[model samples]
Target chain A: MRLSERELVSLIRRKLARSTASEGTIVGPGDDAAIIAPTPGEALALSTDAIVEDVHFRRRWATGFLLGLKSLLSSISDIFAMGARPRACLVSLGLSTWASPLFVEDLFEGMLKAAGRFGASIVGGNITRSNKLFIDMTVTGHLAPGNAITRAGAKVGDAIYVTGHLGGAALAAKHLFGGRIDRGRLAEVESFLRDDVAATPGDAQVELLSRFFAPPIRAEESSALAAAGICTSMIDISDGIGSDLREVCHESGVGAVIEIDSIPVFDRLPGSLAINRRDMLRLAISGGEDYELLFTVRQSDELRLQRLFQENDLCPITKIGRITPNSEGIVFLDNDGRPSEGFTGFDHFSTKEEGH
Target chain B: MRLSERELVSLIRRKLARSTASEGTIVGPGDDAAIIAPTPGEALALSTDAIVEDVHFRRRWATGFLLGLKSLLSSISDIFAMGARPRACLVSLGLSTWASPLFVEDLFEGMLKAAGRFGASIVGGNITRSNKLFIDMTVTGHLAPGNAITRAGAKVGDAIYVTGHLGGAALAAKHLFGGRIDRGRLAEVESFLRDDVAATPGDAQVELLSRFFAPPIRAEESSALAAAGICTSMIDISDGIGSDLREVCHESGVGAVIEIDSIPVFDRLPGSLAINRRDMLRLAISGGEDYELLFTVRQSDELRLQRLFQENDLCPITKIGRITPNSEGIVFLDNDGRPSEGFTGFDHFSTKEEGH
Candidate 1:
C-alpha cells in the first residue's frame, strides 16, 4: 500500500540502516547531512546519473529490484571509469503517487545489495513525489593523491582494451522492445525465464535477457587496473563502444583503429534467435549499456596488463585496437584490414532517436 | 529556442566554468568525474534535495532563476545546519520537453549565482528529459574533524535562537496562493512589483511577496556560529520553527517551551495585508520555507553568541525558547503564559495537506 511521505521516509531510513557504515562514514543517514571522513592523502571523485521511466527503462521490461540495481550501478560506473574506489552514494528518488510501499522497499533492497557488493554505504538521500519515476544518484569515490586516470590521457601507440564481452545487453534490449522478435514470443520467453524453471540447454536468449536486466558493475576489475597504474586512459562503456571511444579520442586528441574480428561479441545464442553475425557485430559496435571498462595502455604494458588480470582472476581483458594520431579519426578495420563504415553509437539526443 | 541535449550540456559546462575551481579541485568537469582533494583531517558533509514542479513550486509563482536559486540554497542550508562549509554541488536536472533553452539557461544562471554566493562551485551534473521539471541537487561540505554540531546535542536549559524574522515567506505564499487575498489582487500586486514602478506607501504586500520569492540562505551566519562553537544543536527552518524545533527536541531527548511574545514575526505589513496577529503567529509557527537558522546554545553562551553575531554584523539572532526535560514535551506559552493547543506544522504528506 502507498504510505505517507513521513512513513515512507521512516521506512527508507530503516531499510538503509541495514547497510553497515564503512570506516569513512563519520555520520550515516538520518541527520541533516552525512559526514564522511576523508581518506587522507587521497582525492575525492564525484559523479551523478539519473534513470527516468520510459526515458531509461520501462517498468514492464524489468522488476523494481533490477531497476534499482541498474540505477546505482550506472552511476557507480562513472566513478569506476575514473579509477576510483566508491565510498558513498546519495540517492534522490522521485516516486509516482501510484507506487506501492513494497515496490519502494524492493528498490531499496536492490540498492543496498549493490552498495554492499561495492563496499560503499548509502550515506544520505531524499525522496519526493512526482508524476513519474526517476532515480538520481550521486556517488563519491576516492583515489590516490594525483593518481586519477582521465579520459584525456590516451596517447598515440596505446593499445585499446575492454573488460568482458559486449552486445548481450543490446540484443536483450532488442528483444525486450520487440525490435525483431514478435511481442508474443518475447513475452513467452520472459515468462518462462521469470518462472524460475531451468532453461533448455540451448536457450542463450534467456541468459542475454538476464544480463540486460541486471548488468554487472566492473568495480573490482577497475580497481585492480587503477591500483596497477597500467591504464593510460579509461571510461565505462555506457553509451556503446563507438560513442565512448569517440569521447576518449576527442578528449585525448587521438584516434583509434579497432579490429572488428578482435572485438568481443556474445556468441552463445541459439540459431532459433534469428540473429545473424552481421547484426551481432553491429550490436557490439553500436549498442549501449554494456557497463564494461574500456581503457588504453602503452603497447609495452599490454602483456603486463593481461598478466595482471590473469593473476588477479579478474574478468577477461581483450586487446581490441591501437590508438592513432588525430588525423585518422576513429576507424573500424575489418578482417582483411579494410576500414569499414557505420560505427555510430547511441546518443540520447541524436536526430535519429533511439530508446535507451 | 530549445537546444539539443548535447548543446544544453555544453552551454551548462561553459557557464559553470565561470566559477573558479577551489584548491581542492584536482580535476574539474569534462572528465568521467571531478576529483577533489579533501581538507586534511576533515569530515565530508553531504546532502541531497530536490524541487519538483507543482509539488514544491508552481511555474507562475517564481521565475526560473529564482527557482534555481532556491533549490541550491535549500540544499546548501542543510550543510550550513550541520556546521559545515559547502565545497561543491552536483545538480541533476529533469527538464520537460516544453522547457525552452532560455529557461534552462536562466535556471543555471541562478544556480551558479547561488553556488558562487556560498563559495561553492558547480563541479558536475547531469540533465535528462522528463514530463515535468525537477532539479535535484547534492551538496558536499566539510567540517573540522569531529566538530560537527548535530541535532542531538541540545541539553536541558539550553536557550533556543533563530537567525531572522519569520512568517514573511509564509505570508508571501499565502498571498500568492490566494489564502485571504484573492488571485486577482495577488496578480495586480505582482504586476506592480514587476513593473519596477514605485509601490504606494502602504503596499506592504509587495515587500512580503518579494521576501517570499527570494528568501536568503543563512550560510554566513551559520558558519560563524559553527566556527565560534556556540551552537549546541541546530537546524534550518525549512519547515517552520515549530517543526524544526520538534526535530531538535526529539533528537536530543529534550522538550521545549517557546514564548508566543518572544517568537519573531514580521510586523511591518500594513492593514491592507488583512492578516491578523493570530494568523501571523500561526504562519510564523507553522509556515514552511523560511530558510532561517534555528539553533540552541548553552545558557552561559547565549550572551556571548549574541555579541559574536553582532560583532560580525551577521543576521539578527533572537532568543525564542528554552529546552526542558523530555517529560515536559513541547509547549507553546501564549502571551498570557498559558499553554496552548493545536500547534501543528506543515508535513508534506499529512492527512491535512498544507500547500508548501
Candidate 2:
C-alpha cells in the first residue's frame, strides 16, 4: 500500500530506532534536526553522495535492500578514505509516487543494517516524492587531531597499495546487463550465483557478480592505516584506478608507474566465463565501483606497514605501483617494463559506451 | 551544453573557492570529505531537506537561483529552529541529462548567496545526473553549551508566539499558481508583482505571492531568543501552525487553545483577493511555508520577552495562543469564544487537491 510522507517518516524513525544511538548522538531522529556531540581533539569529516535509479543501478537488477545498502556504503567509503570513523549519517530519499510502503521499509532496513555494521547511527533524514528513486546520503565521521589522509600528501617515493581484489564489480556488471540472464529470473539467478559461487571457488562469473552486488567497505582497514600513520595519501576506488589514481597524482603533483603484472585481478573464474586475461586486466584497471581503499605509503615503511596489517588481520594489502615525479606522468608499465596505452576509467559524461 | 561531471565539479570548485573558507574548515571542497574543526562547548545540530522539481517548485515559475536559495533557506531555517548558528552546508544535486551548464552555475550562485547571508559556508557537495532536478541540502550548526530550547520544554501555561505575519506564503502561492498569471511570463510577472505591490499597500495578491517566493528566514531572531533564555519551546512554521503547533504540543505533552482574532494576518490585503476575514484567519492558522518562528514562552515572562525582542530589534513578535493540558486537546476559539471546527493543514498524501 502507498504510504504518506508522515507514515514513511514514522516508519523510518521506528526502523532506525532499532539501531542504538552511539556516543556522539546527542539527539537522534524525530526532531527538527539531530544534535551530535563533538568529539574533543578530533576533526569532523563530512561527505555527501547520491545514487539515482538507472544512473547508478537498475531497480529490476537489485532489490531495494541492496540498493539502500550500496547507497550508504558508497557515501561511507568517503569517510573511510579520509581515515575517519563514521559517527552518523543523514539520508535524503526521493521516491516515486507509486513506491510502496514495503519498499520503503526494506530500504530502511538495509540502511539500518549497514549503519549497525559500521557503528554509525542513522541520526536524521528527509523524504520527498519525485519522478524517480534516488537516495542522497551525508556521512560524518571524525579522526584524531591532524590525522586526516588527504589525496594531496603522496610523495615521489611513496608506494601504492589497494585493499582486496579489484574488477569483480565490473565483471559482475557485464553479466547482469549483457543479456546473459533474463530480468524475470533475476532473483533466481542471484540465488544461483550465490550458491554456485560459494560451492565452487572457480565459478568466476558467479563470484564476480555476487561481489558487485554487495561489495565490502574498507572502513576498519582505512581507519587502522590512518591510526598507524602509514598512509600518506588515500582514496576509495569508486571510479576505477585509472581515473582515481590520476586524481591523487594530480592533487599531489606527482605521477605513478603501475606494474601491470602486480595488479591483482580476480582469478578464480572457470574457463567457461569466456573473459580473456587481457580483458580481465582491463577491467581491473578501468572498471569502477570497486569500493576498495587505494592508498600510498612511504617506501621505507612498506615492510612495517605490511607487518602491521598482518598483526591486525586486516584486509590483505597489495602493492601494485610506485609514485614518480610529475614529469613522467601517470604510466602503466607492461610485462616488458614499457609504458602501455589505451587505459581509461569511467567518466560521467563520456560518450563512449561502457563495457558494462 | 551538457558538461561532464569533472567539468561541472571543477566549475563548482572555482566558483566556491571565491567564498572565503571560515576558521572551522580544515579542508574544503576538493577533498573526498570536508574536515571541520569542532566548536568547543557546543553541540552540533544537523538537518537534511530536499526540494524536487515538481514536488517543491515548478521549474518554469522560478529561476535556478531562486530555487537554490529557497532550498538552502529551507534547511537553514531548521538549524535556526533549534536556536543554533549555522556553520556549514553540503548540497547534493540531481539534474537531468539535458540540464545546461549555466543552470548549474545559477543554482550554485543562489545557494552561495543564501549561505553567505547566514554566515554559513558551503563546505562540500555532490552532483549526479537524474531524471529531474532536485537539491538535497544538509545543514550543520552549533548551539552554546546546554542551551537548546526544545519543544518538550513548554509548560501548560506557556503562551504561543510567532514572528512577523503568517499566511503570506500560502496567499502568494494561491495567486502564483492560480489563474491570475501565466507560467511563461513568470520572470516579467515577478518583477511586476514586486513593483506593483511595493507601490500599492493593498495589493494583497501580488504581495502574498512575492512573500512566498522570497520568505525571509528568522535565523538572527531565533538565535537571539535562544541567547536570552526566554523561550520555553520553539519551531519553524514551514508546515503551517496547525500542523506545527500540534507537533510542539504532541512533543511537550500539552494542548493549545488558539485565539482566532489574535493571529497576525496580513491586513493591507484588498477585498478583491476574495478571502473573507474568516478565511484569512483560517489561512493564517493553517497556511504552510511561512518560514516564521513559532515559539512558546512563560506568561510571566511575556513582557520581558517582548522587551528583549525590542532590544534586539528582531522581527515583530505576536502572542497568538496559550498552552493547555493534553486532556483539553487542540482548540481554536472564534471571536465569540465558540470552538471553531473543520480546519485541516497541508498533508503530503491527502487526496484533496491543493489550491497552490
Instruction: Report lDDT per candidate.
Output: 0.80, 0.79
RMSD, every candidate, angstroms: 4.4, 3.7
Clashes of 1: 0
Best by TM-score: 2
Candidate 1: give the clashing pairs: none
Model 1 ranges with Cα > 4 A deviation: A177-206, A270-274, A334-339, A351-355, B175-210, B270-274, B352-355
Off by over 4 Å in 2: A177-210, A270-274, A352-356, B178-210, B267-279, B351-356
Q: What DockQ class does candidate 2 belong to?
A: medium
> Which residue pairs overlap in candidate 2's backbone?
A204-A269, B172-B208, B172-B209
What digit string (tens of lDDT, one per residue) describes model 2 on residues A1-356? 26655677778888887778788677788778888898887889999999887677776676766567667877888999999988889999888765688878778776776677788889999887778888999999999868899999999989999998888777777766565645544554345533432232344555555566556688778878888898899999887888899889988999999998788877766455658777887887888778888999999999989998899898888999999999999999999999888887777666434333
* Candidate 1 interface RMSD after superposing interface residues: 1.6
Q: Count of backbone clashes for each model? A: 0, 3
The deviation in Å at residue A195 for candidate 1 is 16
